[model samples]
Target: MGSNSHPAALYQLRIVTRILALVILLLVLVGFLLPTEYRVERSVSINAPLDVVSENMLSGQNLSQWMHVQGGRVESFDGVLQNDDSIRLLYDESDEIGELTLLEHTGNIIRFDVRPKLSTGLVHNRITLEDHASVTEVKWTIEGDLSVGLLSPYLAFFANDIAGQNFEVSLLNLKQQIESQN
Candidate 1:
């Protein structure tokens, strides 16, 4: 009876080991198949005019008021926020921490190519304003590739939710700032 019980226990252990091995293999395969690029977008409606929202966004001032950035000031910029204009920002009074180049600045749309000093990937940020009768719809989008080779897929899986939450908070701040000013 003892010998039979020992064989049964060994067989159960083997089965459990095989199941764990298959699960690990499946996870690895899924990781390899996941997309490397990720995009995070968030939007809010502001009770302001399109021109007013555009002015606030293009000025690059009041960024710290709405975003998580602190001690932000425009280091260099074209007078009119045209394409190819470069703006440098410093965080927490540290050295210039990030660079943003204007990719497009047209009616109701502003786009920037952002490069953060701490990151290896390029971030594309676009802010679009759609005019409604009494409110303007503001959409903020950030798109980039993880660029971490094999670990990119795992990182991207959570990128949207994490980044999206940040965007949402910033947008809410922007809305509050604009509404308070009006």
Candidate 2:
């Protein structure tokens, strides 16, 4: 007679399958709840010194020149440095109208926090400068988190490549500006 080995064997299999499914469900749930942080960085060496390039880019006036609003702009002046020593900017790039705060500036490093029109979160800009005998090395980094809806984390997997490319372009522009001066 053909017979199953035992009911206990079938019960164990069912338990294992259920446990595996539950683990997968938990992983998916966790993924959806967590927001994704994205970072893009690019670096180039310029013919000038680090301090010189840092001065131009970190200053409010120079920041405005290189940092374009996604769309366009409003008439402006050199940004006023506040009591906290942070530079403030008011401009419209496309639909985004907001301020970019220059947070910190050392000899060769500058930090920025930006408030954009569409979303809520900090966009961090960091510039690092290295002094070389011939040319100065400049590293620019943009790191931020995009708050997600239920489906955003899933889509982020696809969006990261494009986001990285955009970061490259931003760094390229900064590099061009610094190099052009020489």
Candidate 3:
């Protein structure tokens, strides 16, 4: 009876492992079929003027106040690479962890290439400012491609929720800071 029970348990274990392997393979295949391109947008209305909001976006000063970072990774701007239209943040003073460059600035629309190097691909962010009756509406639209990788599409699939929530928190912080100043 003991011998028979041992063989049956081993057989069940093999069957369970085989089923787990098939499930993992299916998940990998599905990830490959998912889209690699992702876009995330978030907006907030600040009770400040258009110029005030635009200045805050363009200032490139005290970025740690409004820029969100999870996991306690702190990066400071490189003074040499910083200009009115561009800001580069680095680690250990030379290793670039993030960069934001003004791609274009039209009448009411401003575009910036925001690459934080936390992951693969270049992230493009567009900021649109509109003057409301008493408040200014600010919109941020970000887009990027995760490129070709087994897990990249899976990351892209969850990018909206992952990055969008971070952006939402950042926008809220910015709104509070801007509103308090006025």
Predicted structure with the largest TM-score when compared to the true one: 3
Per-residue lDDT for 1-182 in model 1, tens only?
88899989999999999999999999889989999888888899999998887777665555545764334534533345669977665666676578778899888988888776546667899998999977999998988888777778988888888778777878898899888888
Worst 10 residues of 3 by lDDT: 73-82
lDDT of 2 at 129: 84
Better of 1 and 2 by TM-score: 1
Give every collision pair in model 3.
Answer: none
Expressed as tens digits, the lDDT of each residue in 68-165 for candidate 2 is 55444322457544324543334443544556666777787777776654356677878788899767887878777666565556555544575566
Q: Which model scores highest in lDDT?
A: 1
Error of 3 at 134 (Å): 1.9
Candidate 1 C-alpha error for residue 19, in Å: 5.3
**All candidates in order of lDDT, best leading:** 1, 3, 2
| TM-score, candidate number 2 | 0.64
How much does candidate 3 score in TM-score? 0.84
Deviation of model 2 at 57, angstroms: 0.7
Following a full C-alpha superposition, what root-mean-square deviation does model 2 have from the true structure?
7.4
Q: Rate the local accuracy (lDDT) of all candidates.
A: 0.79, 0.66, 0.75
Candidate 3 achieves a global lDDT of: 0.75
How does model 1 score by TM-score?
Answer: 0.76
